[model samples]
Target: MRILLTGSAGFVGSHLVERFLGEGHEVVGVDNYLSGQRRNTELFLRHPRFRFVEADVSAGLPVEGTFDAVLHFASPASPPHYQQHPVETLLVGAQGTQHALELARRDGATFMLASTSEVYGDPLVHPQPEDYWGHVNPAGLRSCYDEAKRYAEALTMAYHRHHGVDTRIIRIFNTYGPRMRADDGRVVTNFVNQALRGEPLTVYGEGLQTRSFQYVDDLVEGIIRLLGVSYHGPVNLGNPDEYTILDFAEIIRDLIDPRLGIVYEPMPADDPRQRRPDITLARELLGWEPRVPLREGLERTVASFREVGEGRPERVGVDA
Candidate 1:
């Protein structure tokens, strides 16, 4: 299949591009490099089956192609990155999503949206399932990303229902692995970088805010399965394992240097108190569940950071 993938230079997008190419698919990658790293695409620059286009999806796709699939992974996924460019985040979610849907409609192709777990927003329901109506602040500091994704999901469903576009929505949970920007400000990269540098790990608030971390490979596999099936879903794709920020910090510290100390800071506004996906639907529908343990995933992520060298830390944001 020939796939048109937005944000293909991002951490997850880059990995997805490699996965598709490895599976003998032709992939056209589009990115503006807003928060995505160009170096992530360096390896694939010469791949015969891969083509890269530098463009922002918010304005338009600006490419002509009839693709078998349209994967809309564009957006500032991390809190810091999105918050830094709130308008761009909103535009990408709204306009960019609309453009992708139209492209899929034009080509009569399958459409996959990379939605985030942030839509759950300090969720009142534990182990959030696909049916849970999230408790989100439409005008909070994090709303730039939260509401944008909510709107994107609504738009995706509208396109599916009104226009009969084949659509798939996978609410991605916290994912980490190779190609993540060192200063991306997500918890995994932040902790791993600090631990590697022998610096005190920064923990927000009481450091008890929890999150579910999934390996990128697991997420990519879940996405591929969803695309192959006829399920018009908003499936949760993430590990069911849960960990508090403080516990996660210690785990990374121990992994890098058992003696590293931690410093607690106030938690950011609207930070989710807990996050654990109920992946029963994914298992039942797609026969998918995360396979990488947190310890092992962190080790792999840390190894990548080591190879790349610790990038300068940017302002911390809400934990993914």
Candidate 2:
């Protein structure tokens, strides 16, 4: 199959590119490098099955060939990063998605939108089911990411509804693995970096905020299953195992360097107090469920971090 992948240089996109190529598919990857790293997909540049285009998905994306599938994974995902470019983030979710859907429609290709768990903002429900309408704040600092994803989901379903365009939506949970930006301000990266550097792990609020972590490999496998399934879905693709923020930090500490302690700080605005996915729908619908355990995932993540030194990144700040 010939594939077109947006955000193909991102942490997740790069992995997807490799996964597809490994399956003997020809892939054309497009990225703007705004949040994605060129080095992430650098190794695949020489592969005969891989082609890359440098362009921002929001402004415009022009591809020369028809594809068997189009995976739209563009958009800044982290809170600090997306908050820094709120307008671009929103545009990528809306306009970028529209462009992909149009391409899918024209070529009769499968379209997969990489939706996020952020759509369920500050979720009131304990374990978010796929049917649950989210509780999101429209005016919070995180709204750029949260609302944009909600709009993206709406756009995905709208495309499925109005045009009968074949579309798949995977609501991803917290995923971490190799190639993740060391200073991306996400919990797994932050805690792992701190532990490696012997710095204090930073804990937000009372550190009781619970979240589920999915290894990138597991997340990608679930994504492929959901996209390949015959039925359209706004399906939940995440690990259901839950842990508090502080507990997660401790687990990282124990895995990397047990002697390291933590530093407490106030939680960021619009940060969800809890998050866990109900995958009953995915299991019944797509036969997909996460198999990676949190500790095992952390061990692999720690090894990756060790391989890639935690160098100082350009100071990018958000109003969170």
Provide the overall lDDT of each model, using Cα atoms, as 2-decimal numbers: 0.87, 0.84
Candidate 1 per-residue lDDT over residues 163-226, each given as its tens digit: 9999999999988998887767778888888888889999988887677789999999999899
- The candidate maximizing lDDT is 1
Q: List the residue pairs that clash in candidate 2.
A: none
Residues 166-239 of candidate 2 have per-residue lDDT tens digits of 89988888788877877677788888877888898999899887777888998888877776777776888888
Off by over 4 Å in 2: 264-272, 310-320
RMSD of each: 3.2, 2.8
TM-score for each candidate, following the candidate numbering: 0.92, 0.92
